[model samples]
Target: MSAMTSAKELGPVRSLVPARLDRLPWTRFHWLVVVGLGVSWVLDGLEIQIVSQAGYQSTLGLSAAQVGAVGSVYLAGEVVGALFFGRITDRLGRRKLFIVTLGVYLVASGIGGLSFSLWFLLIFRFIAGMGIGGEYTAINSAIDELIPSRYRGRVDIAVNGTYWGGAAFGAAANLYLLSDHVPVDLGWRIGFFIGPVIGLIIIFLRRTIPESPRWLMTHGREEEAERTVTAIEQRAEAQGVKLTPVPESKALEVTPVVSVSYLRMAKVFFGDYPSRSFLGFSMMVTQAFLYNAIFFTYALVLQHFYGVPKAHTSYYFFPFALGNLLGPLLIGHLFDTIGRRKMILFTYGVSGVLLLGSAALFHAGLLNATTQTALWCVIFFLASAGASSAYLTVSEIFPLELRGQAISFFFAISQGAGGVVAPWLFGRLIGSGTDKTPLTWGYVIGAVIMIAGGLIAWFFGVDAERKSLEDIARPLSAVARGVPGEQSGPSEVTS
Candidate 1:
């Protein structure tokens, strides 16, 4: 359980990275990877939604379950990607695997954009889903490894936080660009193309991305780890800051083996790391259930339940997107300043309560459409703030040696379990012959899940604020939360 490595375990030093939060554009580097990843997802979302918004008549031609299958297909691919690519990256390396994932996406987007048949559409979307699955694992793990403990959550916000950015961009394309702006001939295809174009740019950025130094150190690359620490420190010092040496004690317990079998690595995830793995899985599960409910049910509430038409629904999502935008951007900062535990607990609790309020308001018809919209906006804001932090938190929990693989594992669970279920359950909820009154039940379920997620996070999730991730990755004692560990004032950060 200790993360200490022997002198012989480390590998070549690829680059020198500074470890101080203040030394470099820690936030910038943190945000860049996810923004790149999020852009692809956003464009994909927009493309998919265009199919929903524009092809509604066409979608309706299929059976209701069949309609749901289209979305499910994509989710299925994500599930596959999460499981397979997650482990692959742990073994393969971060930046390179990420580039490969992006390449996979570029191709998937192209296929989806140009698909001529319904089955083909589903197949390509599934492939794109796989790319998204891999993206979350690879990038989040990379950011988690690169960022200091202080900035883990906030920097991670760059990843989870920007998911909405993708949605917002998708929304812009859907509402402004795709809504009769592009040629009718192109319409949804234009939306799909957006991902490939943006994905190309993201792929280009991969040229400069470094592998996780922690991974280097764990693999016996102390030189790379030191380089990473140095570069980060140097950059931070250049910006007029000082760096501390990591407490020597942090790595004292890490056992060093020249190499381990991949199967052994997998066992550690389920066997030795089961507790943490469960935490990640739980985090993903909660997010999945809530998101599907929100995405799928929001439409039903407006059209089937609230009597709004499809044409007007996309525009209404504007306020929702605004809420999503502000919530994460704001929390992204708190991810560092406020710390992940408190921030997650606070938002999760507030959002759960607000969701219940929104449900009650919707049920009572307490407000006119305008009032309802305002209430919904607040709920989305709070919910997104809570949900967005999930990735940030999970990334911090994995050991550097395991960071990339850990990301692959957690994300696979998150996407496979959470992302897919949201829409599917919503369909079952709405399409189930409940006369739409049960729509309020959907909101209620979201409220309950939100509350539960917060509690789960508070109790089980490891705390990383104010400690080095190296320390946080150890057996996770209460001391990991920073009550003067074995070394007094353990942050030995110096260039």
Candidate 2:
């Protein structure tokens, strides 16, 4: 579909770059962007999965409380990394930050493999979390900017959902790493290196992916943006995809600024788009709480409540991870087709309702480990797509100027508020011996939070499907002087 918009306020020279990029057919270039960027989530899943399982192993010698602290500390690092690098991503450009953040992860993960004590492990885990956190902001912004709007929803959801692919791989790796087949002390160290090993290979692939043209134009680099888009078009044509010419009328005229202060960005988000701010918060926090509560503590629940051996926990996790991976792969297209609001509401509502029902069965003591794992598979099958969409929502709904920062802001908030607390609380509950009552209530609470998020989406969600980012949320710098009834405000930044 053509992303042609009537000329609004004309204050400066405009380029049809966004519409041009969005109207292109899918090609090898698009796949390169998807694979190169999406692998960060998989690496994150592997890192978290390895730590979640290994912390319980005898060789690691971590107490239950200490293990929970590991999750909390890692989340803390994510919050810091997002805020710090997120700003840099906006200022310095996506390509630079993507390279830097991945380098940080590689070095940190390799060093983590050498940890002999809890504090040593904790420090590196935090550093690694920072890398993944920065990756979330930089990569999401790049993917959304680079991919055509028509394919954005499924691609984003599928890419985000690949985190579970790493989780499943981590779970499978733990089967051997935690087994008597390998030395207990050395196996855990090997687990830590898995992400870095895979990441080292992917770093080169990422180097081939270009910086965002939208970001380039917003930073007043029109020539570079043109070159980048030309290269992309050349790649598409080389791959035999017919290219459509972008119309001149689609160009947006604006004054591009070098920098926008965080304070002003905050005002733009909260002061002008309060409902969106709230919606982003609601989606992020609910998913963060539910995921951190269950995933980080799944091994403990199995060992305590179900009497599953530490070595066998990964077996349960693999199936659980598979369900999560499959969710977005199966239903992700609906976000673009059935529409964001309906699909998000459906996925969240169904997951929450199923979780509540599962909590009741868990309280009744009717579920064995197998049944419990099966139930989790069913619940998260719906939940994973919804969770992935939270990232999608934040990335797509905001203006390009603050896209990276907005992602970082909501990510930090969700992790700080929900991710940090859930693991510690759940860990304590699991540490309370064989009782399942506390954990049951935790599940119920998580369910309610998810349902509330769905309700918020139904009310406040933006209908951004198949729309250009500029159309969804007009660029901050876009002037609207001549258009009838169009008024420019402090928040309406010209880009």
Candidate 3:
């Protein structure tokens, strides 16, 4: 079906697309969505892990600060990319942006592998960050819209957590590549190729996944939305899954607008849903600061403090990555079952407290390399889930029409405020690797930030578990009783 050419021709549309999507049982199609779109996180993890390795400082003759600047530069790229592509993802469609963004990452990262100097590597790393940043907005938006409400929390968390799987893979690869087994210069360059090669496979897999029907219906492509949902229903039936009938009352009425101006979008974010805006900002910024500060400088800490050889840093990283990966996979279901507010609070609060305890132990001259890594494993096991939930929180709580842009805005803001600063600040704190005092204080600050984020979540977090997107936040385009200007409340529209 062709898209309606003029927004003037569009009218308030009553759609069962969201309901149909939310009611489907687990099927192979869902797995495809998980593997295909979710792999972007893995690529991001690989990039971060590889760049964080201590070998880069020696290989490129970069100072410790320069090594940390590598991460900061990349994060800056992510901020730019999220802001630039996020609006486009909402307007152009999730499928298109995801594919294009992945391609951008693949090409930029492939070129980065050949970098012979610090400036050269930083430039391509920035470009690669842009691609992955765009991927975060596009893929997260797509996953939330496509998955059933029953499984949305767990699936989104698990997918976001897959970043660690890529990190673990990078760590494992470095064990051999950064070792005496491979040439020093060749090892780091080869590491950059891993994500692109994996992405080549995933790009093909993503081709089989459909554009979001929820997005289609809200954007004046109602006929295409129907066809897309119908195809999905047929796929489920073919897999021997019994699909439930969607009641008419479950339908959402959306008045498709040509485009929501940025001015209007800003008002919706700051004016209409200020609390949710704060919630998103808190969750995103805290996680970004904590993760970026620690992960980006983890190898430096190991090499400088513990006398762990640059080649052996991955050994400790293996367990840390494993714990992060397992956190969401093991406990993500609680978000859907026990509830988002409680789970987020537990994860964030527990992790912060653990980090504080670990920092004390380190400060008192008690911990060796192995034990410090062990403590990180324990702390991040909870932190990882909380961080992943941060992504889930922002993606779901906003209106359907603004979902992509909402994620992008929060992500860009968080990265700009927290992510871009953390690595560079921590790098300076890790100055000369001689003073543990500065780095110890940095850890304390991270812990306090996370605890504060948890408190904000407890006070302001939306109880969005098992709720349809429309029910959580009515689309800006939605109207009540076919009245163009009247917005429907949750009670007025069921999904």
Best by lDDT: 3
Candidate 1 residue-wise lDDT, 1-495, digit = tens: 222232233312222232333234454555554555445445545545655554432422556666667777777777688667776776567777778888898898787777666677778888888887777677777766666666556656644655566666676667764455666446667777777887787777777666776666545555666776666556557767655554433333322333344675666567666666776777667866777667656766677666678677776777776777678776567756766667777888888888788778777767555566677778767667777677665666655545655666666666656666666666676774346457678779878888888887777766666566755654211122233233121221111
Return the TM-score for each candidate structure: 0.82, 0.92, 0.93
Clashing pairs in 3: none
Off by over 4 Å in 2: 1-11, 55-64, 428-436, 481-495
Q: What C-alpha RMSD separates each model from the true structure?
A: 5.7, 4.7, 3.0
Per-residue lDDT tens digits for candidate 2, residues 1-495, read 111121222224478889999999888899999989999999988887788775344666777678768777787888889988888898889999999999999999899889878888789989988998999999999999999999999999999999999988887888788778888788888888899999999999999999999988867677899999999999888878888678888887655656677677878888988889999999999998998889878878888888888777777887899899999999999999989999999999999999999999999999999999999999999999999999999998888878899999999988876776887788777775567788888899999999999999988998888888888887766656466334345332121
Two-way TM-score contest, 2 vs 3, winner: 3
- Candidate 2 Cα deviation (angstroms), residue 249: 1.6
Quote the RMSD, in angstroms, for model 2. Answer: 4.7
The order of the candidates by lDDT, greatest first, is: 3, 2, 1
CA lDDT of every candidate: 0.63, 0.86, 0.88
The TM-score of candidate 2 is: 0.92
Model 3 C-alpha lDDT per residue in residues 1-495, reported as the tens digit of each score? 222334446767788999999999989899999999999999988888777775667878999679868877888888888888888999889999999999999999999999889999999999999999999999999999999998999999999999999888887887777878888889888998988999999999999998999889988899999999999999999988887688998887777765678787888888888888899999999998999889878878998888899767777888999999999999999999999999999999999999999889888889999999999999999999999999999999988878989998999888886776897799899988888899999999999999999989988988889988888888877778657646664331211
